[model samples]
Target chain A: MMIKLEQLVPRPLKDRLSARPSDIWNTTLTLEPGNIVKIKAPSGSGKTTLIHIIYKLRQDYDGSVYFDERPLPAIVENELAIVRQTQMAVVFQDLRLFPNLTARENIDLKRILQTPLYDAEKIDEMAERLGVKHILEQQAGICSYGEQQRIAIIRSLIQPFSWLIMDEPFSHLDNNNTRLAASLIAEECKKRGAGLLVTDLDEDSNFDYTHRYQL
Target chain B: MRIQILTTRIDINFERAMRSLNTLLKKLIRTATGRKRFVMAFIGLSVAMLLILSAVQIQVDYNDLLNSKTNQDSIANFLVVNKVLTDRNLGATSLNDSEIADLKRQGFVEAVGLLTPSRFKASIQSASDRFPFFTDIAFESVPNDFIDVVSKDWHWDESSRFVPIIAPNMFLDFYNFQFSFSQNLPQLTQTVVKMIVFKINVYTPNGIMTLNGKVVGFSDRISSLLVPQEFMNWGNSRFANAANAKPSRAILRTKDPGNPTLVSYLKEKGLATDADKTRFSRYRHIVDLVVKIAWVTGLLMFLFAMVIFTLFIQLTIASCKEEIILLVTLGASPGQLRHFLVRQFFPVNVLIVLISMIMITGLQYGAHIWLARQNVYLDTWLGPTTFIAAAAILGLIWAVNRVTIRKYIRLSTN
Candidate 1:
């Protein structure tokens, strides 16, 4: 599956936002399966908002988004839920973790939501690689911010997705942890032959990208 | 291959998950514990109101009154049918031979007897009283078959000049309670009154004769004083002015006093009856009104309970808004959320209804036993109408809960 953004221009933020050049603002982009795309922008430049619109989480944008030539907004809610469950996975900037649930339970919720349920061993292996296994049994709310971010990343990777959308997922992680998390995500994407869209403040050498866009 | 297998299992898993998830949701809500008190209090209040309304809506059995009035030899099957007196026909109220024949022809009437008025002029003089008290007395008689009580001693003997008289039961009550107290005389029992003798004087223009009179029995059926047919016939021949007095009232016996045909027939013929069973019809009307009022009040109480329950649910959802939003974002369908909320509320409603029904039934049974001890018989359970009404109200509560929860979930999801 491919996500095509046609001449996309997001609804501007209410507060301060860095001005986008006309060419970049009006650019059309398509992130296809197996393609790695990076969106770099200054803080508050609607980078998260662009990812949200592609995920159908927000609709306050000027242009249309098509998930494999089907208009994103026209899909019904249940069908969209199905799409989100099996075909798309997102790691939100805020993690969106249920504070009352342990990290393992949070990840298990996403794993059981889709087809070919991920085994517990596989989840623990991924958590071990990202250094979140130690805190996996603790409630997400009581865990450190960096530990919560790793738990959120593990949750997103356990689900089957044709596209993995990350909105500043590694923002709270140090360089060592970021490189480790990036490598695990890359390995999962390569195994599934899925595309990746990672939004951040500046370009990093953690992922070798097929295309780059400024928002 | 994996997606195919998973898709095949989705239906089964979804069903199992819904049940499991609802159980889990109940556990989660139960932990909140803040709203349980309010829910329980409202449930108790609603159940109490329902019990009362259900008890009232039940029909009363008038036969219970018969069972309780065992000492009263009530000839309830007999009705005293009389005609309306009018100025145009001053003697229209008299029961003539034609009217008695017409009454007997009716299918509902089993028997009819014309009342015979006394032919003799008579007055009673009390023998047991310190001061001699004499009062004019009237006598009426029907056939010996119509008399509720019969004894050989009730016969009159012209040779001995002894007459046995049947008096009204109310007359005994009046004398014992009112006259006896006011006159500083002893209140007499039925047995004691039976032992007293009286001087019944039969007077004519030719001569006045004194005869021995004794109280034979008390009649609850007849309000006026009565004498044996033989005595009335003999006295009328000797002292009466040879005028054949037309009977004014007739006693009619029916199979069922509440038979609508009897009432309609009486209405059509402009006849009236002074039977105790007629009052039961009026009593039934009053009971019907009472039941209606109770049902209306119960429905209002149910509405009030619904409001309380709805508020409890609203508070519950509001407290858990964050968790609900998180679940929605995790691809949980609106159906899942609805199932969860419904599970939370439905049990409380079922428990309330069941407890209310059981308590109401038990209360009715207790009341029946209590009344029976006091020689009063009453129906002992919630009637079918009450149960149906309760079931309907319970169903409405469930429906309202579903709709309200669905709406709230939709808003949260959106």
Candidate 2:
């Protein structure tokens, strides 16, 4: 599925964005399926806001977002859940995991949220690759920021999705862990022929991106 | 065939996955926080349901006892009704035609037969000197339907040699217990009395006339000497009298003599009947009072229980508000959450209903056994109406749970 943003600007950042030109904020952009897209921005640039807008979480925006041909707001609540479960996945910048749940449980919840897109054993596989396997049984609340970020990345990859949205997914990770987590995400996206939209502070060689935009 | 096998395997996997998911949801939504309140609500609901269902069962059992053929012999369905004899209306105690019509119009009265009294003076004497007895007597005749004795010889015509009579069993008891001992006469059995022939003398304006009368049957329903309606009509018309006297009493056929409405109707109309027959109405009134008390208290308790349950649900949902929002954000649909909450709460209601039903069944069976010793047979099982009431209450609980869950889940999600 392709995500099309039409002249989008966050209401909170509308005035700030008018002072500077952006390649994405006020412009129409379509992230086609199977293409790895990178959005680079400084802090307070509405990068997370843009992701929330596309994810249909925050509707306080000026313009419309479409999943393929259907407008975001046109999808009802249950249909939106289906889209989130099967068509679109996300790793929030805050790493939104149930704090009381163990890291493994947090990821397993997503895996079983719809159908079993991957076997239950796959959680261990992804956790092991990202080097967070030892902390998988630890509660997300007590886990270190870096460990929780890797757990969040594994959670996003555990489900079936055509578009994976990440907002600063590696902010808490070290360089080595970031590369490992990035490779795992790239591999999962490549295996499903799914698109990736990652927002971060600066340009980095995470994956060979088909398009890069300043948000 | 290969595709079908694959589909079945997928279905099994899906089922397993959903089971795990539900377990996780149960862990997250900790309904155990208000355990005390839940237990209290459960107990309240059980007691309420018990009261309500027992009321239904008691009514069913009472009806069965009154109308069941096995208990019919103990209770009389026919009653001889009359106006209460008061000094002011001493000679005017006879019921008017309109009063009889009004009695017929009552829903509880199945049939009314006016007791037509003989207008002329009459006397009865034994035909043989072996039992020489003579007494001034009056005869009353009622319609054939109101007669309880099934005697084939109870019909009369102009050519008949003897008039058939039905003496009240009370009179026989009076004679056997009191009259015979006091007068030094032999106590006669019913068969011996039936075999005796007697002379009936009717005094007319012209002269005295004599006819033969034979006792054909004995009745326990009406407490009077009953003759055939044909004889009474013929005797009253041929013998000289002032005019046809209005009927002072009437026999009523009712399905349930214990009905309170019939009793109240009798009192309201200034009519009277054999108090022994209508004594069942007093017990009925008590049962009615008990049943009504059970109903009102049970319904009030049920309402309070529902309120407690709804508040408990709201409290649980409120406490987990943040978690629910995050869960929804993580793609748990409102439908899923609602289903999970329903599973959490609704099974206990079903269990309560089932437990109440079983208790009522046990009580009914016990009642049946206990009352059976008293010769009042009741069903060993509960009536269909009781089951229907239980199912209706279960359905109502389910609907309430569904609506409460939906409302709270939606509130938290939004």
Candidate 3:
């Protein structure tokens, strides 16, 4: 099933409006299964806002989001998380790692999360693949910045998800690291038959533009 | 279909709630382990305080009520006096046989006997030895205290032809030994004994009494020796007995021989005793005082403790609000957050219930033991039953705390 957003935009935007009346009030986009697309915009653009929309936080918008070709316009409240879990994963820019949990603990959060029973072998494999196997037991806060960022990405990617969403995920990575992360993410999405929607201006990595929406 | 949907939704919610609870529990443990001393203090104090107060009091009261002397009802004798009725004709006196038949038919009485004076010169087949002359007293079949009035025998006595009944003061008074009582009365209570035949007298009524009666077959206390009214009648007729008379003195037994109730029932039936009135009143007063004290103490303690507990919980919840808000912000739904709060407080409630039960048991023990010392007895007070009660009490307390926490959520939402 594909999700299509027609003329979606923000409301009066009381908190984030540091400027005058804006015409970026409406925009249309089509989100399909396993489609790798990016919404490219400047730093201050509402890319994160757009991402939060899919997560159903800022719902004050005039958009028709169709799922399975049906207009899921009202956005069933509790089911939004179900949609997020089976349909999307967001690697937030802040890397909200629970400070109390170790790296391995952080990765294994999905086990204690919505799902019951996480596989130990799968967790170990993901940790090894992300090159964080050695530092799995270390407290997340004590790890270096790059290590924290990698752990965050690995945590997000470790679980099986049908859609991948990110807000400036590569902001802290070099070109080579970005390429490696991109390749790894692509391999993961391809294997799961997942869709990808990323919003960032990481121009140097030169992602073969699947599709781009300018904000 | 609607039922099916509701079921499915409930199932999913149940699952979500479980996961949410598990997550919150694990988080609480991880966080709480760093501050073990605080938890230990709260739990330890709660247990100790509750156990001491609750358990001990329950034990003491329960014990006292059980072992008291008159636990079951009782019957008290108020005034029992030996008196007789007489007709001023021939001095011979005895209860008329027809009256005995009438009393027998009444049927509310136990055993009826003729309680003759010890000196009564009547021969009973059940007696061990033969009684002798005027001064020869027999304790076998009569009230021993009547010997003091042994001065008289009621018969035209001192003659072998007619024997007198050794009826002591009662016979003399009833047959009117001194002329004003009865014109044909026996003269000189004793000298008249050998001269004429005197008869023993008795009146007894009928019923089954409710005392856990002593085995009459073998009880040391026998209030009255029974002279069969049949025998008394035979003697009265055969001796051409003294003046005719009416049946006068006999005792009746009643039912339900226990406190307040027994007294009232007996009073209602015209069988109450003066002693019954006094004892019943005392019991009512003492029971009323105990009940009033228990209720007043229980209410005051409940209200004061509840208020303090509510305020303490309000403060603790307020302090932990930030932690709750943080969880909410992290994509925790309202349901999840509520479950988290409930789960976090789970251990606290368990500790409270456990401690309350322990303390309640102790109180019941004290009550039971105290009552036992005072001779009280009971089978149950603080076993599984008390644990259930404590759990219910704690559950209600927890529910109240949770209801208050919703306001915190509403404020945070706003």
Q: Please tell me which predicted candidate would have the highest TM-score against the true structure.
A: 2
lDDT of 2: 0.89
Provide DockQ values for all models, in the order shown.
Answer: 0.20, 0.74, 0.14
Model 1 regions more than 4 Å off: A13-19, A22-27, A113-116, B1-33, B36-49, B52-83, B89-271, B281-290, B371-387
Task: Rank the models by TM-score, top first.
Answer: 2, 1, 3
TM-score (0 to 1) for chain A, all models? 0.94, 0.98, 0.82
Tens digit of per-residue lDDT, candidate 3, span B153-228: 2223223232222332443444454543444433443344333332222212222111110101111122333222
Q: How would you class the docking of model 2?
A: medium
Question: How high a TM-score does candidate 2 get?
Answer: 0.94
| Candidate 3 wrong stretches, greater than 4 Å | A13-25, A60-78, A116-118, A121-135, A202-209, B1-25, B28-70, B76-344, B362-370, B380-387, B397-414
TM-score of chain A of 3: 0.82
- Report candidate 2's fraction of native contacts: 0.57
Report the C-alpha displacement of residue A213, candidate 3, in angstroms. Answer: 0.5
**Considering DockQ, where higher is better, how would the candidates rank from best to worst?**
2, 1, 3
* Ranking 1 against 3 by TM-score, winner: 1
Interface RMSD for all numbered candidates:
3.3, 0.8, 5.0
Model 2 error, position B142 (Å): 1.1
